[model samples]
Target chain A: MNALLRNKLRAFLTMLGIIIGVASVIAMLGIGQGSKLSIQQQIAGMGLNLVTVVPGSQQRGGVQFGASTMQSLKETDVAAILSDCPAVLAASPEVRGNGQAVFGALNWPTSLYGENESYLQIRERSVTNGRMFTDRELSSAAKVCLMGQTVVKNLFGEGADPVGQVIRFKKIPFLVIGVLDSKGLNTFGQDQDDLILAPYTTVQKRVLAITWVQSIYTSAVDSKSTADAATQIEETVRRQHKIKASDQDDFTIRNQTELLSTFSSVSNILTILLGAIAGISLLVGGIGIMNIMYVSVTERTREIGLRMAIGGKGFDILLQFLTESILLSITGGIIGILLGIAASKIIGSTMGWPIVVLPSSEILSFAVCTVIGVFFGWYPARKAASLDPIDALRYE
Target chain B: MKKLIEIIKLKKDYYVGEVTVHALRGVDMVVNEGEFVAIMGASGSGKSTMLNIIGCLDKPTEGEYILDGISISSLSKNDLSGLRNQKLGFVFQTYNLLPRTNALDNVELPLLYNKTVKTKERIERAKSALESVGLSDRMHHKPNQLSGGQQQRVAIARSLVNDPVVILADEATGNLDTRTSYEIMALFQELNNKGKTIVFVTHEPDIARCATRNIIFKDGVILRESEVKDRINALEMLASIPLEAD
Candidate 1:
């Protein structure tokens, strides 16, 4: 240890490159993992337990095909899907548009949504205040509304409770029954706590003045039977729309499992890409170790010769030198781990991502640096050990 | 009498690419315990080659070389190194101290390689060796910090650390001034009187005259060996040796 510390300048220069390289690897991996976790959460919150049914275009030998518009789904279609899809836990039909929302001199243009009470349950969203509409309210098509937390906050001040307050939407007055719990933002940059929810019947008859609904959502009991629920929903919707048996139906069902799998695949690829970039820096660092080790061997050649003269075997010289290199790299690896963790936190805080530093990966980086030191340091040390002592002593 | 080292018809050869150069030609000699012998030679003489072979730092081409009654010719490199570390010590013209290590640690280095000595014992023994050579006050001083005579004393201390059977010096005072050279010579005589055998090299007649006997070499063979009486005292010799004012 004293001998190792004696060559302080050489040790520090050798460890510097390794530290920077490992720190980069850690920071890049940390940030990348943070984003993956965050995105997964947002996707999971969207009732990844649910499946979405949209329209699939009919392909003819893969030519002259355009997207098939799914406009036939409506309140009745949603009801039939709920009843027939036994695997489904709940279901809802929703129509979305944009309109001016007013609450006594505070008016703002917001994304308008008309969805059934079950929409909140199917999507795993809940209200922080008030309650979902009653069964009578669903059948009677009440004019009451449920606003997202953001909409409420925008119309009212931060401290105000929006429940029981009457807000006007495009010249129609409706009392707010609930303010939604904040769901933050989704992967597509859309705020989940921004739109308003009301009865589908009212939205269909009044707001958009359209006859057909936009999309159908059916959630499974849990994660287990999402694909089965989606299949059942597709079958029910196709039959309720009264499409001909010979004609190709337009709607397609996409399960949360498939979407999640796709997301994870992309994220894994992204993680690897970022990791490889970091690994390249480590490779350069390994080369730097090789370079410095060669220089060290040259500088210590005479000393190596002296040790040999005094009873140090070739392998003894090799072991001592190799141990020195490994010690240098491991020390660098430890410092790099600390620096990388700190840098990752700084970046995460700045970008608003929840970065997590994994200890196992840090250990992995340290191990890799150790291997790098030994592997790259072997040749130069071997050369030093093989030098004839006679020539070495006679060397200037 | 116990023979510390013996050589019989030891021949050493060197090959440079396709050409061969014979460095030793069947040389035979024996060195006993506590014998201070000087081997004197000119350029291209085999005295240095003889020194290397006797020192166990090189293998003889074709000869039976026995050290401490064990045949060294057939010993593996590792075995030879072990023998050298346990039984022999060296002092070179350059003083050959590791650049960064201080005096005490340089003395400690051989003990470190042995590993049989406990850590505390190793340090204590090293300090004792330094103290024996009168370098205890300079124990922490690096080689570069010491003058020529002090550096040689540190090297002598390093040589004595393992209590080696023989202390070999190669042109030991070649790099020093006359005053320093005699001072180093006095230290060697002191160590020799303490029961350590000493073998050193020199071309100077005056330096050779200071030893118990001198073996003169010419063209790779010992031409003449002579014993001397009334050996000069180091300090008195330095005082008498003539002229420079600094």
Candidate 2:
């Protein structure tokens, strides 16, 4: 221990690369873990209480295009399904189109969505200002619009309350009823917090002048009943569309739980890719340690021989070299861990991502450093051990 | 007294670029319980090779060497190390003490090899050996911290720590000046008088004259033998030799 400490510079030089390598693995892994966790939390915060279904078949030259031939779903179907499906706690149909809305002097072009009173319940959305449209307003096709927080901020200026004010959609007057809570940006980089919502009846009759609805959402009593409720709704919709089991349906039924699974699979693949990349860095560091150890053995050949001649055996020489290598690797591992943590923290704070340092990574990196020490330092130790005492003593 | 070391027809061979170099020709020799014998040879006479073989650092290619009744050829490496530790001591002209180690630690090394010697006993023995060599005041000094003569004394003290019967000194004064060389030779003579067997090698006639007996080697063979006069004690010889101020 005393002799080893005396050669501090040599030891430090040997460990330098290892420390950098380990630190890189740790920091990168931490950032990855943190980001994965944050994304999962963000998805969770979007609320799995809602489910959506979109059209998938074909319609000739209509707004439904070549995908769905018959647009079997409408506002009436949503009403019938809501009344027939007792498993469904609530349901709403949404219709979307490009439209220009003018409020006072500002004229903004945005995607306009039309929904019913149950839209907030089915979508798990909250109102930030004013109130949700009443059932009477939706049933009567009343001209009331719920603006997204982004729409309000962009068009109505900061701290502006546009509620109860009148706005025109394609020159038809509509009253601003409420504003949606901010949902930030999602994985596809789309702003969920930007867009406008109005009654489905109003959109079909007053805005788009179309009879077909685009999509529908339903909220179940709990997460466990989501699959059952989707099945029940799908059956009821198929009966209403008069489609047989052998033929493909016009619309698709989706559950939010399946989406959760899809997200996990993609993230898992990404995490593995990241881990492998970091592992390559560790391997590079291991090679660096090996190269330096070989040089050390060559430089200290005379000392090795001298030791053996006096009384040291082959094992003693092996131990000395082994100790030096391990010393280097362990010290480097410690430094790398610290650096990795600091880097992760910086990434987490700056990028608004979660940076979690998992325990397995710490253990894995330390073990990797040790294995690097043994594997790379072996050749030099063997070289030192096999040298003849007489020749070694003669070495300058 | 009893015979402590015996060498019979010992021949050590080496291969240098496909050419055979004979380091030791077939030779028979013995050193009794208490004797100081000097080996005199010119360069390439194989005196160092002979010393190395005697010191158990190497084994002869063919021949039997019996040290304290154990055949060196039959002993395993670890056993040979044990034999070297228990039976033989060595002194070199270069004062080959480990550079970073203090005098006390240098002397304590041989005792470390012997498990029977406890740490306390090793320390006491090392201190006594230093006192015997008149370097007790410099026990804590490393080799680089001491003068050439003082370093040689520490080496001498190291050789005596294990209390081996036979002490091998290969050109024990080859690296020092005349005055320092005589001072070392006087120390060897004193250890020899205290019933320790000395086997030293020297090329200079004056250095060879200090031993009680001298065996000359030439062409891998003994060419001459001289009976040295042992009438004077070591301190008297040390005093007679001229000295320069340190």
Candidate 3:
């Protein structure tokens, strides 16, 4: 304690490196964990049992038209998969396009989603106000739509009621029947609440002048059966599309399990990257500790001699110096943890980013700091302990 | 009195690169309980080496040293340390007290090594040791805060804390002026009168006059051993000197 106070500035400077190292480790891990958790939550909100079927790439006269252009998915396919695929619990046909939504001299560019009432259930969202399009409206191909929060804000202004009003998509007039509850953003950074939804029949017949939808969205009976439902969907669509056994599939099936694993793997890599970088900085801090401890041993040669002369064993001397170093590092570690938590909290609140500081990381950092102290302090303590008292007491 | 220290034909050699310097050559010495002895010699006469060996800080190249009935040659490093803690005390010319530690803490150092003593008892023993050396008022003062005489007195207290069988002092008054030297020697005389065995190493005849017996070293061997015809009591010597002169 006296030695540390004797060189307070140097001690603090030494601790500074460890402080920064630990703080950065904690903050980086917290931010990474926060984003990972946020991503997982967003995906889960999309429906854990959800699966998607889109048109596969088409080859015409040896020329490939890229995926999503073939438009092989139809409303009949949604009905067929719902009936034939036992694992499928719910299915909705989606005909997607982009257009300018016009309502009383106000216009906003937005993506249009043509889907049925079941689309709301499959997407795990509900109407904030008003009602969904009825089966009567869907059968008659009525011009009725539900606007998203972003579209409502852009076309009608914030807090403006748009239900019971008329809007235009591609110059076709449609009645606005409801507003969708907000879903901020997806993992791909796309705004999920920025599009409007309407009955598939109206969009396919009036806006695009087509009979088939662009994709089919389905939910399985349970999370465990999502992959089975995807395979069953592929078989049913294949039979409907009249593709032979030797021919390539005309549709592509994507399940939530695949997407979730891919995203989690990416997040895992990012967390490890951040942790490894933090570990390197901690190593640098450990080296700094080692350098300072060496200097301290050299400076306190006389003190070592005095203790040894007073019947202190070599082990006692070693323990004393080692304990001092461990105390220094652990103290720095605790302060760094506080600084890290504070920094992450500030950044989280100010920048509107999610932050999660896991208790495991805190414990791990504390443990690593102690190991670093022991590892780096060994040589210096040994040097102090091994000094010959006859010469050390005579050292200038 | 039982023999506290017994050495037969002690020899020590040092190797500086290639040449072996014989620091001690065939020296025989005996120190018994309750005896105050002074060892005097010129530089390179092995006085310091003899003190170090007797203090258990080093081992002789060729000798039979039985310290308080324990054979020095067969003891391990840990056992040597234990012997030093339980049996011998050392006081150096520079009064090698830790600089930033208080006088009481410095005195408590030896007790820290003695596993038999508990923490609370260690403090009380150190406090009384400080009081015995007349430094109770300066117990909380750091070594740097104390004068040369006071620092040496603290070192003496440190040596006495364990109640060792013998005390070894190498030029204990070398750094002090004549009056403070005499004052410190007065403390030593008082400790000796209390039945503490003290072995002192000095080159000055005046300081040698304080010990009851004198042994002079020449090269590595003892050249003469004699009792003081008239010992100078340090307390009486200090009374003759004026306070202002000190």
Candidate 4:
């Protein structure tokens, strides 16, 4: 304690590396954990026990157009999936488009998603303001629509009741029959609460000027059967398209299970990568501590000799120096954790990114810092302990 | 008087590359209790080497040293440190007090190495040691805050706190001015008079005259051993010279 206090500036500078290393590690891991959690939450918010089927790309003379351009999936395919796949509980045909919505003097650019009553059930979205489109409205292709929170805010004004009001999209006036509860944003940072939903028949006939649906949204009875539902849907779609054994299917079925697994694996790698990069900084910090400790041992050689001559054992000197180093690192670690949490909160609010300061990461970094202190402090402490008392006393 | 230190054919050598330098040839010495002994020699005469061996800070290359009946050469490193803590005290020419620490804390350091001493007892003992050295008022002052003489007094108090068998001083007055040297020697004479054994190394014959006995070294061996017939009173000598103002 006396030796370290003798040079306060050097001691603080020695602790600086540990501080920066721990802070960076905490901040990076916090951000990574926040992103991972946000992704999982977004996936959960999308739907439960869900699978999506889309038309495969169409090839003409070795030229391939994007998916959903082939028009190989239709409304009959959705019905066939619901009837043929026992694992499938519900399904909906969908046609999608993008257009500007106009109400009074306000205008908002939004996605026009065509879905049915079953789509709302499968999507787990509840109408907050008014009733949903009925079966009568679906068969007649009624031009009644539901608005998300963002559209209600932009076109109708915040907290405005737009139910029963007529809004114009693509020059066609549609009555607002319902409004959905806000879902905020998706994992991709796109606003999930910025779109409008209408019956698929209305979008295909009135908005898109088409007879074919582009995709189908289906749900299994429960989460555990989602994979089985996807397989059954795939086989049904392949049979409906009449593809031979050697030919490629015209549709592709995807399950939330596969998406979740892929996303989690990707995020796991990302978290590890961030941790490794931060760990490098920690390693550098440890090395800095070691270098400073070596210099301190050398500078205090005479002091060591004097202590030894006065009856201090080698173990005493070793413990003293080791305790000093550990104290330095642990102090830096605690301060760094506090700084990291503050920085993470600031970044979260400013950039609108989710920030999670995991307790596990905090404890782990603290433990690692202590270990680094011991590991780096060992060589210098040993050198100080093994110093010859005669030579040390004689050192100038 | 009981003998406190026994030395037999003490020898020390230094090797620089292929050449071996004999710092101390065959020599023997003993120190009895309540004695003020000065070992005098010019540089390269091995008085420092002899002092180091007697202080248990170094081992004789080819001899046996017994301190308070424990053979120094036969003892392990830890045992040597234990013996030093239990039975030996050291004062250096540099006034080697830990810098930036208060005088009381500096004095308490040697006692900290003694396991038998309790914490509360260590503080009380250190305070009395400083008081004995007439630095009770300067106990809280750091080494840099005190003058050269006061710092040496603190070092002396530190050596005495353990109540060792002997106090080994190496040129303890070498860094002081003339009056301060006389003052420090006066304190030493007082300590010796109180039944404390003292062995100090000095090159100055004037400093040796203050001791009751003198052993002069020349070329790695003792050349002469004699008693001081007229040991000057350090306090009377200081009174003859005018004291300087701060």
Best by TM-score: 3
Q: Report backbone clashes per prediction.
A: 0, 9, 0, 0
**lDDT (Cα, tens digit) per residue for candidate 4, span B25-50:** 98888889888999998899999889
lDDT minimum window of 10 residues, candidate 1 chain A: A64-73
Top candidate on DockQ is 3
Q: How many Å off is the CA of A300 in candidate 4?
A: 1.8
- DockQ for every model comes to 0.55, 0.29, 0.62, 0.56
Error of 2 at A77 (Å): 12
TM-score of each: 0.81, 0.76, 0.85, 0.79
lDDT tens digits, residues A1-396, model 2?
Answer: 345565677667667788778887887777677666766666656656565666666655654455433456787667767888777888888888787878778878877888888877776678989999888888799999999877787678877999989888788898998999888877678888778899888898888888888888777777678787788888888888888989777788777687777876777677777877887888888888788778877766766655665566777778778887887888899888888888888887898678899989989899999988888888888888888867776676
Please list the Cα RMSD from the true structure of every candidate, rounded to 1 decimal place.
5.4, 5.7, 4.2, 5.9
lDDT of 1 by residue, A1-396 (tens): 455687788778778888888998898888778777776776778877878776656566856356545465667877787778889888777788789999988987787777777887888888789988777877777888888878887899786898898988878777889878888887678888888888877777777788777877778987778878877787787798777888767777777687788887887787788889988888888788778778877877778777877778888888887887788778888898899999998988898777867887798898999898898778877887788877777876
User: lDDT of model 2 at residue A100?
Assistant: 81
Would you list the clashing residue pairs of candidate 4? none
* Model 4 TM-score on a 0 to 1 scale: 0.79
Q: Which ten contiguous residues of candidate 4 chain A have the minimum total lDDT?
A: A39-48
lDDT of each: 0.82, 0.80, 0.90, 0.90
TM (chain A) per model: 0.73, 0.70, 0.74, 0.67
